[model samples]
Target: MDWLTRANRRIHRTLHARPANGWKPDRFRKMALPPIAPPGWWKALLRLPRDHYVRLFTRHSSVHPPAVGRCIEVAAAMGQVLVTCDGVGVARHARSWASHQTITDPEHTAAAAAARKASAATKPASVEVTELEERSLETNDRIFDVIDDGLSTGEGLA
Candidate 1:
């Protein structure tokens, strides 16, 4: 594609300026296959066709051509992850590939971005404690206070 100009140049230089022994087909195969992309390469890969890469996920979003095929082999999670560089995750995104479209899970992206803001990291979101549990805790606190007072006062501890 448009981003492959450098790759094209390198390929041209290698192929056209052949060695005295001529080209080795195996070397050409090695050249055709890319080595690990240095971080952010996934973004460039996104510019290419989806058919060329296997989709993958990180903690915060979806991505293409997973760090390794095994990166996407997990059974849990889908549709979201972070963008990794050099096998270590660096940025978050909601993953989607739909023909020149950018897709993201808004809430997921928000949370991912919030991670950088540190202050936005909060305790696990509140969950509704059953009314019974709420009452039990308050009642237990008062009862313990009374028992504590009694023990201090040398009153009935039996």
Candidate 2:
């Protein structure tokens, strides 16, 4: 591909150039395998040959996996490795491979239940009898004042 020349060069320099072995057959074979593309480029390239890119650019473009595979091969040759989601370099959602067991303490559970029952049974001390008495007095005074003010006088006529 037209964009592949720089990548090919990088691959040759990183993988093929071995001063010690001078291009061994085994090394070449290993390098021939496809490499993982950079995450950004890979994701972007994956959108190609799809309507997303075509609609954005208002132009038709076709992409083949072979080109991407070649790029990956070149990257692999250059010792560029792909990191899995769990790898330190990769961003991943929080996950646990192993199941987790929640531990419950019998004594603590019993204590909590007992406390809840005790609170439920308690009537919050009934707002103190003195406070209730004061509120009742206030309400009676208001009623008496309303009666004296002639607002309740209309009831006699009715």
Candidate 3:
């Protein structure tokens, strides 16, 4: 602070032909203080109530009372999630425990249902592929023979 003050005093200003210290006394009183922050300014830094949730597509993902119990157990195991003995504080996808009624966002539910229906129309059924038995190096000989035949017949390039 002393070094800065001494430096400020030493440096001369070309406009007034004087050091910075000479201008400080005149300007100091007139300078306005910084604006104060509004009440609950710290709240912006924190996670809001709505933010703490594991969202799921209700159309694809179903949730009953039994699933809520499983969710609480999973949340407890995961650690950071807010979990009580009764239910999980996270995930808005589930039904209310008291009313036993599902409380999904209406807009989101409609959108998910539409998307699910669209995908189902286009998507193929589950495909099952059988594993092939390991063959000897001789299996590649057939491919090489075909390549050699093509080259010999001038069908390789032209």
What lDDT score goes with residue 75 in model 2? 9
Per residue, candidate 1 scores C-alpha lDDT tens digits across 11-85 of 356467434334466566664546865443333233212221233432223333223233322122244444444
Q: Give each model a TM-score.
A: 0.19, 0.20, 0.21
Candidate with maximal TM-score: 3
Deviation in angstroms for 21 in model 3?
63
Off by over 4 Å in 2: 1-101, 128-158
The global C-alpha lDDT for each of the candidates, from Candidate 1 onward, is 0.43, 0.35, 0.41
- What's model 2's lDDT at 32? 48
Assess the local accuracy of residue 83 in candidate 1 as a C-alpha lDDT between 0 and 100.
Answer: 49
TM-score of 3: 0.21
lDDT, residue 21, candidate 2: 51
Clashing pairs in 1: 39-85, 60-81, 60-82, 61-80, 61-81, 61-82, 61-93, 62-81, 62-95
C-alpha RMSD by candidate, in order: 17.9, 24.8, 16.7
Give me the runs in candidate 3 sitting further than 4 Å from their true place.
1-102, 125-131, 134-158
* Tens-digit per-residue lDDT, 57-157, candidate 2: 23222222212222211101122222122222211122222234222334434554666688799887655545343466558758677564456565665
